[model samples]
Target: MPVVLSLNVAQKTAPADHARVGATGIDKRPVDGPLRVSPPGAKGTAGSGVAGDSIADWNAHGGDYQAVYGYAREDLDWWQSELGTELGAGQFGENLTTQGIDHTNALVGEHWRIGTALLEVTGPRIPCRTFAEFLGQRGWVKRFTQAARPGAYFRVLEEGLVGPGDEITVVHRPGHDVTVELFFRAVTTEAALLPRLLAAGDSVPPEVVELVHRRSAVELDS
Candidate 1:
């Protein structure tokens, strides 16, 4: 039942009100047919793993770890209700807009077989100033942080083609309960949850685990 409702790619970029001075690839549009998915190398080098998609802000946006961004259509509908606006696919700049998938509850290190490409969940999308500017909503960052439906960034495990309407199969799911929502909370508002992130093991990025250890050391010293 979990299928990709739409496959979106950034069509263009222009000046924006974000930290990235030149442009922001936040305006993504749904595309037809198969789109290639592969590792986009590093942040400064490659941008989006989805072929034809663009990433304007490389310094903090794209990399092998964040090859693709996925968001749930269900969550978008919820936001529509909250904001009283009809949101189209890729409105949140997601590469894959899926239906029937609980992205918020999806665990880190989860593997999804979508079309021919394989993707692994890496972390939650941290809302930034660009997101706020794109949405044009007051206190957007705080609201999104509190809502905790930040979506999830994915790493391409196997390069292949992906398209809209493709069924998403969960080929693997991590044993840990470190869901994306939990991870976002840990790094954002809920500092106490940081220690619990260790339960996720290497499923989450090493920097996250290192942060947990550093926090513990700081706590011990103080």
Candidate 2:
């Protein structure tokens, strides 16, 4: 059974040496109380703008399709071994640090009933320059990408309050073989896997669906 190991939230803060010149909410810290969760907005406009949470980069951080991010403690343990450093909850900027669920094998469109909220697994977190900078790690983006264990992002289907220790119940799963890891691979280093994403249909977010179609078309044309 999956469970929320920790809940984290952060406020926008001024840029650090590595972060860009603007507020960044990636420095999330563990919270002791229940935090409200909701869908920020549709697609490109969604964010974690619910109470007590913030999204610094409205252009990139939040929207309907990425209302919350979840990373597995198991995966974090793996990174801890490789990086030789202690990583606390939300170190990866995830709102919920989870345990038990295999994020890599989480099927796209899987729905989780956490506390009073319903969330749908949308995709995997792709490594970005901002994320790399947050870690202040040399070649962090390349390293994380090669590791290929990026955690999951979710869209809020039903809003509610959630806290650490909340049980995560899988309420539904779309009948697709595409897992979060597979989708990430298709969009990143494995272009050859693009076409298979279509089998998941509308379970995948529109933007990525479009990407897959475009890439598949190019592959065929070439």
Candidate 3:
């Protein structure tokens, strides 16, 4: 049984990364007690939950498909060793820091029941310029890409409260071979794998499915 090691929310602050020119809510910090969890709503709409946790970039973040993000403590440990620094929970801007779960390997559409909320894995967190700037590491984006240990993003299925130490149980897993790592690879570096994403059915994000079909069509035409 996986568990939430810490529940975190973003701190509204001036843009610390090149990804945004205005305020960015990427500097997440651990919160005490239970935190409300729900859909961030559709794009162009404000994200739900705590007031300050709102998505700073509507064009690239937020929406029902990416309501919450999770990162594994194991992966953070790995990065700590590489960077020779200590990383607290939520350093990666994840809402939940989890323990004892293979986050990168979890299958898309896998459901995790935490507290009273049900969340389904949507996809992997792709590193962006903002994340690179947040860490202040040169070539961080390329390094992160090469590592390919992207954490997972989930969509809220049942709105409820979640807090640290909540037990995480996999209540459902869609029958599919498309793990988060595989999907990340398909999106980032493996064009051939795009066609294979169809095996995951609707488990894949609608936009991702459309992108896969578009890429597949272009390949066929060429």
Candidate 4:
């Protein structure tokens, strides 16, 4: 029984500087059901554009998915142990910290209720260079990729509102043998497992499916 341990939201207030690789300022705030997303504006805040309903945008620029941010139950402990601070000291970036659910094992298409908001786990995040830069550690992205427990991303199926301390309950879990962790490993390392993952089609997203197909094709051609 997974539950939402905490919730957090932040706004980037300043441009990146030499000393800082990401937004220079972050303002944590509260939000309710029906999250909104628009194209970034001149002021840097997201403007009313297309609603952010895609995994690519949620994971882009810095793993900025609001839904997945709810899975950061471990961040607080990790930050305190390693960085000697809490999540809001401008070191670790995440929103909606959670607990109880094994996010890596969440099946794609599975839906969960976080307070009044409905979120569907769509896919696992693909780690990128920005992750490495954020930690000031070279190759950190590769290390995280290799670890293969990339957290889940969600789509707002029934928009409402969510906030810190919201409870999360699984509403649906598709039958799939492949876990998000396994899918990530297959994609980044043991590509031979791609076929098996794809066979569990219900649990994998189209982009992941295409990526596997492309890699397998290349391997066969080579």
Candidate 5:
């Protein structure tokens, strides 16, 4: 019964001298189906298995789909409280701000419906230098990585327009044991949790699994 408390969009704008490029402007759009376009700055080369039309592209670049990257919403107050600031105002790198569910707990392959659009939770966001630039803090990337509460990223299985104040509901929770957070941790901190994540029996994407395996081996050797 989670609802979208608010939606926002970034308009094209110049990046701050040292500030990471946040989305240009925040606005409301319609959600009609799965696989929406990835927001600007997140697009990949053609046929990268990434739908480049909507907000998914931005997400692929380690941006949050809802709160900090595309739009800003208050529904993510918990993130602010936990991080001790306004996350949507540019703390968490989200696009669409949401409420009701803990994004970190949302697993891969899970489907969620917001308004008319359906999105499948695909993975956890990986922190990057952009995040640190946006936050104006050194070690911001490491801080987020160590926090282990990476937000969820989604792929549009159906395409549709979405806007602010829509209702976001879970349509399906895949019965997979591996979770988005675990997958993220496995890749980021391969030495610590990779084995456990593999043992969890969750369906991990091949790219992610391989990344973790390689890193894990390096850690063991060191």
Candidate 6:
């Protein structure tokens, strides 16, 4: 059964490097207490859904659509081996470092019940310059994208408190086969896979749905 291996919250601090703005919360640390979570409105106006956690880049991170981040421990382990480095919980800036679930391949729109909260898998966590800088790796963004193992992002549907060791129950899964990996592939390296993302309907990002429709129209015209 899937479980929350660790619950991490960001410890906001001044820019860790020149790659970021005034401050950044990319270096999340594991927390033992229950965390309050809720919808954080939108991207620019919000910080983080997990109360006490911080978000420095209002333009790029945090919002109702990405209220939570879940990365599988298995993937982190893989990265540790591939990068030859020691990575701990929250290394990837994930709120919930999970175990026992194929989190990276989780289908978009799947609902999960962890603790007293209900969350829906919304999209794939895109690798950003901050992430690359935080990892201190060269071409890290390209490498991460190539792996196609980007962790899944979530939106809290029913707000509540959650903590580490909580069992993650997948309450529902959309019928479509739009896994996080597929979503990443469609939006990034493989443009040809975009059409298949249409099958996900509204489960994916609104911009993605609109892009698919626009592309479909262009193809029809051609």
Clashing pairs in 2: 46-62, 46-63, 46-64, 47-62, 47-63
lDDT of 5 by residue, 8-37 (tens): 333333344443334322222333323333
lDDT of 1 at 57: 85
Clashing pairs in 4: 8-96, 32-161, 32-162, 33-160, 33-161, 33-162, 34-160, 38-49, 69-95, 70-96
Tens digit of lDDT per residue, candidate 1, span 72-156? 9999999999999999999999999999989999998999999999999988999988888898898999999989998999989
In model 4, which regions exceed 4 Å deviation? Answer: 17-68, 75-92, 200-203
Task: Tell me model 3's lDDT, rounded to 2 decimals.
Answer: 0.84
The weakest ten consecutive residues by lDDT in model 5 span 45-54
Error of 6 at 90 (Å): 0.7
Better-scoring candidate (TM-score), 3 or 4: 3
Can you tell me which runs of candidate 6 are displaced by over 4 Å? 214-222
Listed per candidate, the RMSD to the true structure in angstroms reads: 1.5, 1.7, 1.6, 5.7, 5.9, 1.7
Clashes of each: 0, 5, 0, 10, 49, 0
Q: TM-scores, in order shown? A: 0.94, 0.93, 0.94, 0.69, 0.66, 0.93
Number of the top-ranking candidate, with lDDT as the measure: 1
Report the alpha-carbon TM-score of model 4 versus the true structure.
Answer: 0.69
- Tell me the tens digit of each residue's lDDT in model 2 across 1-222: 789999988865556655454567888889886888888887555458355776777666678778899999999999999999989999999999999988899898899999999988888888877788888798998899888999999888899988999999998988779999999898889988888888877767788888877876887899
- Return the clash pairs for model 6, or none: none
Instruction: Give the per-residue lDDT digits (tens) of candidate 6, residues 1-222.
Output: 889999998867557564457578888999996988899987678978998888888777888878899899999999999999999999999999999998767888899999999999988988988898888999998999999899988988999999998999999988888888988988888878998887776667676788888988999999
Among all windows of 10 consecutive residues in model 2, the one with the lowest summed lDDT is 12-21
Off by over 4 Å in 5: 13-43, 46-84, 89-91, 191-206, 212-222
Candidate 1: where are CA atoms >4 Å away?
A: none
Cα displacement (Å) at residue 100, model 3: 0.8
Q: Which candidate, 4 or 5, has the higher lDDT?
A: 4
